[model samples]
Target: MKKAKITAYVDAALFDEIDALAARRRVPKTQIIEAALASFLSPDSAEQSEAAIVRRLDRLTRSLERLERDQEITTEALALFVRFWLTTTPPLPDDTYLAAKAKGKERYGGFVETLARRLGKGTTLMKELPLDLPGSTDPR
Candidate 1:
């Protein structure tokens, strides 16, 4: 049933608080007042309870954190899997490392260009890591 609007005078402090809440939410003051009345009169107040909303937000935050952690773990697992495949996986005598190298090049051809961009360098299609390491000197 549509109800007519009735004006009731509230205390100055309470009216100011309602105005502040309206400004904070960027909504008209009338809508906020109507929402408060509806919430109070609605049968399933528990569904719109502030406590339930807080719980849902907290749960979502935990879920996001878990996903970030799982992604890191998955990244580590992929790295370890790659290392194991390159080092320990036995290959056919007929199959040479050149074929594997070619496959790798085809798969991750843009890896170097992406790395350079991520390191704050301008994107270059062809890139070579210029690193001088000690103890193992093999210049190829």
Candidate 2:
């Protein structure tokens, strides 16, 4: 195929960039300029770019939704635990207060250890929850 020659003016910095890129790739500067012009003038370039951006946005939206759902689950679990603890636990008498505090500390340490082990094993309350649980929006 025969090629046509045309003169065009570009920014000095852009010219330098094209020169550098051509040198690095061991190709003629005209080749790089031709490829860049072809891409810019392609009919479907804008649509292809927009489609790629939309795909990324869709992925981000799904990730954000999952984060929101996880946050809701965590908040609900904490609220339920607090309500149950407040209603069921009786106030300790002054006579047994010190003993109860010591026992509570020991039990808390055991609970922490058990929690660590479960986490290390990748076990989670979310995994144990039924898919059909009330108020759950999880599709899995």
Instruction: Pick the lDDT winner.
Output: 2
Which regions of candidate 1 fall more than 4 Å away from where they truly are?
A: 1-48, 95-140
- Please count the clashing residue pairs in each candidate, in the order shown: 0, 0
Whole-model lDDT per candidate: 0.76, 0.91
In model 1, state the lDDT of residue 20: 100
* lDDT digits (tens) for residues 1-140 of candidate 2: 79999899999999999999999999999999999999999979999999999999999999999889888988999999999999999999999999999999999999999999999999877776655488866565
Model 1 C-alpha lDDT per residue in residues 1-140, reported as the tens digit of each score: 68688899999999999999999999999899999999888878876587789999999999898678667756886899999899997775656778878878976868766776767765322222212334544322
* Each candidate: RMSD: 16.0, 4.5
Per-model TM-score on C-alpha atoms = 0.32, 0.69
